[model samples]
Target: MSATVKPRYQQLKDMIIERISSGELRPADRVPSENELVELMKVSRMTANRALRELTDEGYVTRMAGRGTYVSDFRAKSHLLEVHNIADEITRRGHQHSCKVLRQSRQRSRGKIAGALHVEQGVDLFHLLLVHYENGMPIQVEDRHVVADFAPDCLSQDFRTITPSAYLTKISPLQEAEQVVRAVQPNAAVRRRLRMADDEPSLVVIRRTWSHGRPVTFARLHHPGNRYELTGHYSPPGTPKSATGNVVELEIYDHE
Candidate 1:
């Protein structure tokens, strides 16, 4: 560690993230208490307290008055590729789907978003964040970045009435999509929006689509693991003349 790495508090906060990434920490697992961390890491009380405080604020740990802090679930394991709407995905499982728009704004791209869209350091980008409900319960939180080049009229649409998922499909047919999945704890802001419990785990899916050889949009969909699942089917070509059995399985990254 560098002498002037982040503050001890931030370093401790990062440690929680590292442990979660390594599976050393897990959802519902009680994290080391501030006193425990101080004794183990040989840090000051203030440093230990800062780490726990930040972790709680970041939604990486849940702190109880009398009980110790517990780890949060930050990974989505079930991955599948299928063309379906967010509403249909939930309703298929006997759950109702509802969405609430928390924010819709126009901003310039930054960091990796700018790089991915191949735009300048600051280019107009449409941003949206929504909370999805299932059977009157929050299930998924969606955060998206739109490529203005493909959907110039997106800003004019009213997301309060129509979902981004539905709107995008209505305007453009699927050309190509890329998706990725990983475990990530919700930030403080997202945690509250999803109404996630202290013990619940969260899954994040990042998707990007392209049309006319140009990037169309990017989305990050977060799901509560306890109530969501993804499924898909596929068949291989030229699979004839099978005496007993000949089957090939496929793996699809649920994205875009």
Candidate 2:
């Protein structure tokens, strides 16, 4: 069976998002008006209007009453849930964040990874192994893979200075994402990477993200179970939808 094609308005939305991800359209920059898009893209005014209207509703752009629309100063967020960059999360908490790049290379997708990336086996992909630190203490082990076609220069990035999450999101903003939180005992290598105790469990967040309807990146973010957590807060059904997005809070529990 053939895959379903997206509507023209959705295509227009994706194009605008791609531009934003590439830094071609910076936050607060003026976006082309509906009339301009209709003329530039050769689409009907209705299509252009729907695209701009949806973008505004999704917080990607803000339409002024009198002035033109402008790109919103918003960080890229996932569709299912928020995926915070470790560096940004730490910085937001007023702590220093750093990382160590343990590995960066090209590898062929195999087994579950092939399916996870929505690519065939033996397809070449970029891989990175990193450990993130907060306030000088190791906190997260990030093992990630990127589809070669989506981010061809993934290997050249210095993850020690900029995290894979930050770099990838900038390359192709997330259109969709899924994450599974797990509690399990990690292997010796992962245990050593996060500097966890022998009996300590690991809090792992397995994530797969998509852009343009294809899965482009897969990651396993592991942390010391005793030290990290994720919590969610959503408005009740009766409450109005937030102009921003869902609220996700991170808490640290340092065990002795």
Candidate 3:
């Protein structure tokens, strides 16, 4: 018995990926055109096109309508344990940040919302749904629940002018927080709002914050997996580590 051979398109894709991994092709470097790949690899035009399309979809490269395809820029990364505002994060990257408040109202907490906020099933809570954009590209969908006791004016604030995180911080300082990160397939609504492809997955960060030992807010943030990553750095107690210590770790999640 013999092992199966990969398709021609896959072989071409692997070759291009190898070049990228080896730094032969750097970010924004123009990739070989379909015709060029076909001539060089002796593969059909269809095969070359398929390989390039897949690379674009996978975020390895970006294709412009008239311009040629180029290697993609580094995906944006966020600090998992940081409580910074998304707008601030975007601006720090030298990109424009904008937000659309999809929904903002007072609602009664129930089921998972109640559990996350640690409130009674019917207790009033301020709910907010917002989509954040960086350089006009939708990057995150934020669904948040705020305990009324913590931020009484949550519903009145204009989210387009001020983000929920900023408002919450102004009302009560964050004392403690916890977060869980997961990768999931986006539903139709999420995909549509994020302007993502049908096959794109999402990286979701579910977080709960406390102020003065009381639950302040619970937020679920969704990011396109191809465009965002989460990272963290920490050290154990009783160890004086250097700035370049082994405690600095990075995790990269790539979606299929």
Candidate 4:
């Protein structure tokens, strides 16, 4: 009751975001178009457009020039994936999993996201943005780009219910994946999304996944350093058997 009244467009944007968070706006559900908003909310076309634009930027909806806008449901699910899946990690801890899809669309791959896939600049790629949850707690934010040719069904999948990681592995088996980790500070946008204190540090992991001997996707996962750790297993090209006559096939690497 005490909340102050915000601008008309901002109020509209917040209302849309609330609907998305409450599951009222299901994934892939189209929201009221600008024209509809102008009529229903008695707001100007510019105000309605601004609301929709903010929603799009916040990853609640996907806008297409001729196709209109629809809710996004992208998440990263884990499946013992020959690759890491963020959503799965939360479930493994006995936590209920969820995600707020920020964005999902076909974009021209470039820079590192392109380099990891070994694709040419402007190659068609599926880009995704999501904030991951565990037991209703925000844990990480996943920003990723996938090879369209490898997971053609990606856009159609509901990321809210099923993690994109799970969908990808199901459609195209993963052959190998490589991950790199580092520490960094959050930017203004990341800081706001993660709801972190100004001084809190963060850990970032970049992963490249391959399928059928070709790189298929690249992702950057961000986590609050204070609340998370990274773990993995590594083995050298070849190693002698141990004294117990067991081959050295596994090595646990837990990085905090």
Candidate 5:
């Protein structure tokens, strides 16, 4: 399979960001209008609009009701936590990454689905179900829900070529996220899809990602316990050996 390519909108975003990084697009400088971008990049109007809208949402640009868009006095936010892309991880491990998209559709959120995305009940949303593979072996099953408004083009992407994770990151940079990890037995269908033994449990990570102060995506990611392992390293402040330490320190915050 051909290597996954960055979406056109993301390419446009990268171009503008590179300009900003190189000091060509200074803060408060007028950014090219959507029409200008359409003419310059040869992308569709929808593509130009999405790129700019996402840039505004990500604080890379500011848009005025009447005036044109302009570069913002943007301060990049540090990622308090890192969310690794599965495809990148697989490639780093010298393995091929691929996925099968099982379900992709729009639906109304109900019950826990609504609560998970932090949206009102019955809000229309996009749902995706995928089974990820490493070297042709199934490793994970991901069930994801995205806020429809945040990703208007969610339904059109050919997910078999690009992962939902990669696509969503381009929608808007992650502002915040919450995660819950658990070990449990998944449903028979998922277990079979992962090729797990009947007695094996699954390692599950339930994640909710926020952008522009709104939860935009909620996902349940499951891995076969027998074949998958979770690893991490912690480098705390002022620790000489922390950089290479395998021990992770967890912080507990008081409700007060």
Candidate 6:
């Protein structure tokens, strides 16, 4: 029996991915062109192109029409059970996080927003739309509305320097939190802001927080599915013992 050998294109792809994982190639760093790869690796242009094409499809790289291929800016996973600031999450991954306040103003709470915040349909509410980026790549679109009375200064604060989640936590203690996760195809506006393809689905997390039994904030966070994921670890209660008195370990993951 002989060991199987990989195709030249696959070998090339693995080499490039290794560079990326090793920190030798960073986000936005241009990868070698197909012609350059062909010259350096002594492979045909078709093989080189296939390697780059596969990388692009797998979300490891992106190619521009006029420009060249560059390493992709991918997502950093954050636990769904935790209520941490997005800036902190990005920084924990050793990447720079930036926020762009797309829109911030006082708007009348209406429809679903009103219901979620437990406010009257026509009552004034603080609305903030923000786009958060990691290493200069857009990763999340946060559309949040706060109960006006809960955070009186919500509309006046500079969200670019401080995230809405952090600001809300500072103003009031979180007594309770509720979250709903779903997979959906983003709307045109959201797709444009996230810079994702029209057919690409997104992971949407709708979170509502309350302070002292009063609704404080409701937020809809959208993350591109290919670039982001939610993960959790759980252990069963009451460890079981085997017949021989050996301890048993149990772990479960719910991908619901």
All-Cα superposition RMSD per candidate = 20.4, 14.7, 20.5, 22.6, 14.3, 21.1
Better of 4 and 5 by lDDT: 5
Who is ahead in lDDT, 2 or 5?
Answer: 5
Best prediction by lDDT? 5
Tens digits of per-residue lDDT for model 6, 63-163: 99779999998664232354456788789879999999989999988998898888889998988899999998888999999888888988789988889
Per-residue alpha-carbon lDDT of model 3 for 106-137, expressed as tens digits?
99889988988888899999889999999999
Q: All candidates' lDDT scores?
A: 0.75, 0.85, 0.84, 0.79, 0.86, 0.85
The CA root-mean-square deviation of candidate 5, after full C-alpha superposition on the true structure, stands at 14.3
lDDT of 4 at 79: 27
TM-score of each: 0.57, 0.61, 0.60, 0.57, 0.62, 0.60
Q: In model 3, what is the error at residue 231, expressed in angstroms?
A: 3.4
Q: Which ten residues in a row have the lowest lDDT in candidate 3?
A: 231-240
Q: Model 6 segments beyond 4 Å from truth? A: 1-84, 235-256
**Model 1 bad stretches (over 4 Å):** 1-80, 235-256
lDDT of 4 by residue, 42-146 (tens): 999999998888777656688998888798764632323133477777777678888999998989988977888999999999999989887776778888899
Clashing pairs in 2: none
Two-way lDDT contest, 3 vs 5, winner: 5
Model 1, residue 244: displacement in angstroms? 17
Q: Cα lDDT for residue 99, model 2?
A: 91
Find the 10 residues in a row with the least total lDDT in model 6.
Answer: 234-243
lDDT order, best first, reads: 5, 2, 6, 3, 4, 1
Candidate 5, residues 1-256: lDDT per residue as tens digits? 4778988998998898889889999999999999999999999999999988888877789999779999988566443444467788788789999999999999999999899788999998999999999999998899999999999999999998888888998878656888988999889998999999989999998889999988999999999998776665433222246446454555457799
Q: Provide the lDDT at 117 for model 3.
A: 80
The clash count for each model shown is 4, 0, 0, 4, 0, 0
